[model samples]
Target: MDIGYILSGFAVGFLVGITGVGGGSLMTPLLVFLFGFKPIVAVGTDLLFAALTKTGGVWVHHGKHKSVDWKVVGLMATGSLPVSAVTIYIIKHLMSVGKEITGLITFALGIALILTACALLVRSLLLRKHEREVESSSISTGRFQGTTQIALTIATGAILGALVTLSSVGAGALGTIAILLLYPKMSTLKVVGTDLAHAIPLTAIAGIGHWSLGHVDFGLLGSLLIGSLPGIWIGSHLSARIPEKILRPILATLLLLIGLKFVLA
Candidate 1:
């Protein structure tokens, strides 16, 4: 029922619908800096918020565009799901032993935000470089690289799993950039779809784990969803009309500044 929370959610959701990033990267920081929530609670609440908001995106991409690459999703999930569970277990154990982890979580969130900003800034350059590398490779080398890329994808998933569970900030911009770097041949649509598809279960599991640790704020979650759902719907419809070249750099700059504040605070 807090209008400020609702407005913040709508803003984040609108940006996410347009750029396919910013859910956790923006929301977690807002919760911490603006609303004065603890880092753990902010991350935990944002995880479920991200999961629910992105479900509609998966449906649109899979049903209408058929852009989801299930094989890649399965491979990524193979690594991410287990690691996510283990991360939750470790955090739970630490908290049970009376460890004070608020500062740790804040630092982790700051690092993740910084990485996400860097990923956003370099996304196009990374893709172009990947394409050049692909073009220069020999056929035999290509086959070997395929096998390697699969392993790399799973490894990337494991990294995301740990990062997302700890901070709720890596599964959007960071995930998309990692997918593009690994699968340079994939179309943007496929990369977005696959990333979103993988994010659903990862966030769900992580959110549930945080819930068990009493980190989630259901009231905040509900308020966010109320405005975000509509915001996403509107923003998606307008995305194609927007110039991403203009938007991304601005968004990236904002994330970078917020990240630095968290890290230095």
Candidate 2:
């Protein structure tokens, strides 16, 4: 019943709702730096938190039906799932070697954060460029190219699987940017939905692996959920009124600062 943890979750959830980034990127750092949790514990907790939170999102997206691209999700899962399994085995093996894993986790988290910041900053620009590309390209059965798009999607998913398994980051922000770049003709909302749909399984596998390694703290997870569920709901309701152009750069800057701090630490 730590009020501070609950409040932090609320804030993170609100920001995630508006920005569509920061779930794993910000939450793990907050737990590690502010709450003084171990890097592994923070990452493990956030992975499950991400999985559960995004489940609700997937439901919403599926309800809309048009927002989610199941083909994309399938391709991503195909690549990501196997990599996630291998990463879990590697991390468990690393853990058996003792305290060395902590430093590795910290290093990975910092690198992922820097990448997430850059992804956020460039996300809008990518979207605009994508729009232009879409206008220039001819309509094609309302679908992307067959083999090339699938290959890129799987490759992106493999990257996400490895990074998220290591640091519990990249499934959201980095995933968004990669998809937008690979499938520039996709609608923004569809890209988000597909990414989210893929994240549930990816995070759940990683989370469960961490749990088996005794890194997850269920009490902390529950407290975070208590605050974040309502916060995301409220933020999404209010999102239309906010100016995204102003918000994204600021968020990116904050992520850059936090990432730099972790790297320096």
Return the top candidate by lDDT: 1
Which portions of model 2 miss their true places by more than 4 Å? 132-146
Clashing residue pairs found in predicted model 1: none
The number of the candidate with the highest TM-score is 2
lDDT of 1 by residue, 117-183 (tens): 9999888566546543322222223223776867887898999999999999999888888777666
Q: What is each predicted model's overall lDDT from 0 to 1?
A: 0.86, 0.85
> RMSD of candidate 2 to the true fold?
2.8
Pairing residues by index, what is the TM-score of model 1?
Answer: 0.92
Q: Lowest-scoring 10 consecutive residues by lDDT in candidate 1? A: 134-143
Q: Give the per-residue lDDT of model 2 (tens digit) for 1-265.
A: 7898899889999988887778888899999989999999999999999999999999988796557778778888999988998988998887677647887888888889999999998887877665532222222323457676677778879989989998999899899887777766767777788889999999999999999999999999999998898889888887888998889888888888888877788
